[model samples]
Target: MVELLTARGCDVIATVGDGDGLLAAVATHAPDVAVVDIRMPPTHTDEGIRAAIQLRAAHPGVGVLVFSQHAEPAWAARLLAGEASGIGYLLKERVSATADFIEALHRVAAGGVALDPEIVSRMFNTGSRPLDRLTERERVVLDLMAQGHSNRSIAELLVISERAVEKHAASIFTKFDLPPTAADNRRVKAVVAYLQESKP
Candidate 1:
C-alpha cells in the first residue's frame, strides 16, 4: 500500500504496527492524512476503527482513510458517528485500482467524503423508511451526495442540469425531514440517516 501511494507521488510517512503507534506517529509527524487498516495486531477486530475515531477527535485537521478487508456498515457507521468530512472508507479490494485509490486519498485529504459505492448501495438497500420515500432519481442524487460530490459534479455525472441536482437535494432533505441546521452538516446528516438505518 505504501508503495502504491508513494508511486502515486504521496509522501510516505512513518508506518507503525499497532494503533497506539499510529496515534503517536500522527501526533509527532502530523501527516496530512493517515491510511489505516481496520483490523490491527492484537485483536485484529476493530482496533483500527477505534484508533481512527480517536485520531479524528484528537486532530480533526488530519484526514483519515479506513481501508478494510471486509465491508462492515456497522463499523462504518460507528466511525462516522459525529463528523464525515475529511474521512473515507473503502474496501481493500479497491486498492487494486491505482487511479481510483489515489483519487479517494486526494478527496479525503481535501476534507471530502469518499465512501465506497458498495457501502452506499448497502446503506440504500437497508430499508430505511425515509429513503423509501425518495424517487429513483432522488436516490441517485443522494448516493452521489453521500460520496461527497458537489451539486455540479453530480450534475455532470448524471448529465443533468445543476438546477435539477439542487431540486433532488431539496427533495431528499425534505423527505428525510432534515431541515437546514447550523449545528449539523446536511450532507453528513443525510449520510448518517442512511447509515443509522442500516444498523442491524
Candidate 2:
C-alpha cells in the first residue's frame, strides 16, 4: 500500500508498526497526512483509532485516514468529534480499488474530509443530535470548508463573493468557538472542537 501510494506521486514519509509508532512518526515527520490501521501492535484493540484521535489533537495540521476491518461506529464517533477536515475513516474492504483509495488520499491531503458511506449511514441510524441549527446554506459552506476549499473556491462554487464566504466562515467560527484566523489554522481548530463536541 505504501509503495502504491508512493508510485502514485505521494511522498511516503514514514511507516510504523504500532499505534505508538504511528503517533511518533506523525510527531516527528509532521507529514501532511497519516494513514493508520484500526488495529496496531500491543493489544491491537482500537489502538490505531486512539492514536489517530491523539494525533489530531496534538497535530491538527496532519490529516488522518483510518482503515479498519470492521465498521466500528464508536471509533468513528470518536474520530468525528472535534473536527472533520483532514480526517477519514474507511473500511479496509473498500480499499481494493486503487483509484478509489488514491482519490481518498488526495481528498484528505488537500484538507477535504471523507467518511465511508456505511459509517455515515450507521451514524445517522444510531440516533445522533439533529443538525437543525445550521441553515442549508451554512451547511453547504461547512461541507466545503471541511473539504479544505478556500474562500475564493467556495465563493465560486456558491456563486457568491469571497467576502460573503468569509462572513459565513466567521459565523461558523463563532458558533463553534473557533478563533477566526488564517484559513488553515482556523480549520484545524474548528475541526478539533467539532470532534470534541461530537461525544454525548
Candidate 3:
C-alpha cells in the first residue's frame, strides 16, 4: 500500500504495527490520510475500528480510509458514526484494483465518501421493506450509487442512457425519503438511512 501511494506521488510518512503504534505514528507523521486494517495484533477483533474512531476524535483533519476483508455492516456503521466527510470504508477486494483503490484514497483525502458496493448490499439485506420499495432496476441504480459511481459511469456500466440513470436515482431518493436539498447530500443520506436501518 505504501509503495502504491508513493508511486501515486503521496508521501509515505510512517508505518506502524498495532493500533497504539498507528495512533503514535499519526500523531508524529500527521499524514494527510491513514489507511487502516480492520484487524490488528492481540485481540485483533475490532482494534483497528477502535483506533480509527480514536484517530478521528484526536485528529479531525486527518482522513481515514479503512480497508478490510470483513464487510460487516455493524463495523462499517460504527466507523461512520459521527462525520461522513473525509472517511471511507472499503472491502479488501476493492483494494486489489489499483486504480479504484487509489481513487478511494484520493476521494477520502479530498473529503468524500468511498463506501464499498458489497457493504451497501449487506446493509440492504439487513434492511426491512425500505429496499423492497424499489424495483429491481432502481435497486441496481441505488447499488451503483452506493458504490460511489457517477451517473454517467452507472449508465455505462448498466448500458443505459444517462437520463435513465438520473431518473432512477431520483426515484431512489424519493423512495428512500431523501429529499433533494442543499443542506444534506441526498446520496449519502440515503446510504446512511440504509446503514441506520441495518442490523448487525
Candidate 4:
C-alpha cells in the first residue's frame, strides 16, 4: 500500500508494523501526515487509536488518518477532541477504492477534518455533551490547546495578546466547570475531557 501510494504521486514517508513503530516514525520523519491501521500488532485493542492521540498531542502539525475495519465511535471521539485539524478516521474498506482513499488522505494533509460516514452515523447513537456554551473563538482556542499549543502560540495564531489568551482560557474553564489548578495540569485535564466528548 505504501508503494502504491508513492507510485501515485503521494509521498509515503514511512511504514511501520505497530503503534510503537508509528510513534517512532512520527518522531523521526515528522511527516506531514500519517496513514495508520487502527488494528496494529501487539495486542491490537485500540493501540493504533491511542498512538494517534499521543501523536496529536505531541505534534499537532502532523495529520493522522486512522483506518479500521469497524466503526468505533469512541476512538473517533478521542481523535476529534480538542483540535480537529488534519485528522481523519475511516474504515479499511474505503481503501479499496483508490480515488476515494487518496482524496481522504489529501483532505487531512491539507488541514481539513474527515470522518467516515459510517463512523459519523454511529457517533449519533452515543450520548454527547452540549458544547454550545462556548463561543466560536473559545472553541478554536480550546482546540489549539488540545493540540498542545502554548498560550503564546495560540495568541500569535489568533492575533491576540498573551494576556487576552489567558483570560479566554480561564473563561473556558469556568464554563466547563473545571476547577482552579496548575496551568499545565489543567491543560491536560481539559484535553482529556475534550477528547472524551468530541465524538459527533
Candidate 5:
C-alpha cells in the first residue's frame, strides 16, 4: 500500500508492522490519514481497529481507513462508534480497485466516510445492531457506568453535570427496553445488556 500510494504521488509517511509501531508512527508523522489493516502482529484479531479508535480519540484530526480480509460487521460497528466523520472501512478485495481505494483514502482525509458496499449491506441487516440505538454520548456514559462508576463519578469524569448523566442513563435504559421496575435493577440490566451486545 505504501508503494502504491507513493507511486500515485501520495506521500507515504511511514509504515509499521504492529499496532504499537503504528501508534508511534502516527504520533511522530501526524499524517492526514492512516491506512490500517484489521489484522496485526501478536494477536491478529482486532488490534488495528482498537488502535484506530485510540488514535481518533487522541488525534481527532487524523482520519482512519481499515481493511479486512472478510466481512466483519462487529468491527465496523466499533470502528464507526456512532460517528462517521473521517472514517473508512474497506474489504481487502477493494484494494484491487486502485482508483476506488485511492478515492476512499482521499475522501476519509477530507472528513468524509467511505464504506465498502458489502460492509454497508451487512451493517444494515436486521438484528445486527444490538446496541446501535444508543447515541454516542449515551454509549460513553454506559461504558463508564459498566466500570462501576456512580452517577456523580461519571459526571466528574466526563466533566458534565450529574443531572445530565442521569438523563443519559435514563435514555440508555429506555433504549435497552428496561422499563421501570422495583424488583429488577434496571441499571444492572442495562449494564449487562451493554456487556453482552458490545462485544466483538
Candidate 6:
C-alpha cells in the first residue's frame, strides 16, 4: 500500500500498528489525508473506523480515506455518520486499480467523495437502488423513521402494533444493510440512507 501511494506522489507518513498510534501520528504530522484500515490491533473489529471518527472530530482539515476488506453498508454508514465531505470509503480490492485509488485519495483530500464502485452502484444504480430492497410496508415504516418517528409512534401512526413496527423497522435496517453496533448510531445512519435514497 505504501509503495502504491508513494509512487503517485503521496508522502508516506508514519505507519502505525494500532489505531491510537495512527491518530497520534496524524495529530503530530497533520497530513492532508490519512489512509485508515477498518480493523486494527486488539479487537480488530472497528478500531480504525473509531479512530477515523475521532480524527474527523479532532482534525476536520485532514481527509479520511477508509480502506476495508469488504464494501459494507454498515461500516460505510457509520463512517459517514456526520458530514460526507472529505470522506472516502473503498474496498481493499479497489486499491489494485492504481488510477482509481489515486483518484479517490485526491478527491477525498480535496473534500470530495470517492466511494467504491460497488458501493456507488448499490447507492445510485437506477432501478436497483438500496431502497428497492425494502418491501412496500417496510418503505412506509422507513419513511416514518426518517421523519423521526419512534417504533411506537410509527405504530400509532400506522394503526399497527408496536411490535409489528419494530419488526418492520428491523427488517428495514437489515434490508438497508445498516447493522446494529455500539460504536455507530444505526438509527441515524438508517435515516441518512433513507434520505439519501429519497433524494431526486
Off by over 4 Å in 5: 127-200
Q: Residue 28 in model 2: shift from native, Å?
A: 2.3
**What lDDT does candidate 6 reach at residue 51?**
92
* Tens digit per residue, CA lDDT, model 6, 1-200: 88888899889988888888988999899999999999999899999999999999899889999999875656777777676567888889988889878988987898766666566444443454667887878767765554345678889989999999988878877877988876545555665674354344
lDDT of 4 by residue, 1-200 (tens): 88769877988877898878889989999998998877777887778888899999998999899988998767877777757678888889888878878887887887766667676444334434524667768777876665446799999999999999999888878776789854435654554464467544
Which lDDT value does model 2 have at 193?
51
Model 3 error, position 4 (Å): 3.2
Q: Estimate each model's TM-score.
A: 0.95, 0.66, 0.86, 0.63, 0.63, 0.64
lDDT of 3 by residue, 103-162 (tens): 989988987788987888786676467788999898888788777788899999999999
**Best by the TM-score measure:** 1
Candidate 2 per-residue lDDT over residues 1-200, each given as its tens digit: 88788788999989899888988888889898899998888888888888999999999888899999886666776887756678887889878878878888888877777666565445334433332445667657866765456789999999999999888877767766666555556754544454444455
Which candidate comes out best when scored by lDDT? 1
Q: lDDT value for candidate 2? A: 0.74
**Per-residue error (Å), model 2, residue 59:** 1.2
Q: Candidate 1: how many backbone clashes?
A: 0
For residue 124, give model 2's deviation from the true position in Å.
3.0
- Runs of candidate 4 with Cα error greater than 4 angstroms are 125-200
Considering lDDT, where higher is better, how would the candidates rank from best to worst? 1, 3, 5, 6, 4, 2
- Candidate 2, which segments miss by more than 4 Å at Cα? 127-200
lDDT scores in order: 0.89, 0.74, 0.84, 0.76, 0.77, 0.76
Positional deviation of 18 in candidate 1, in angstroms?
1.1
List candidate 6 stretches off by more than 4 Å.
124-200
In angstroms, give how far residue 194 of model 2 lies from its true place: 11
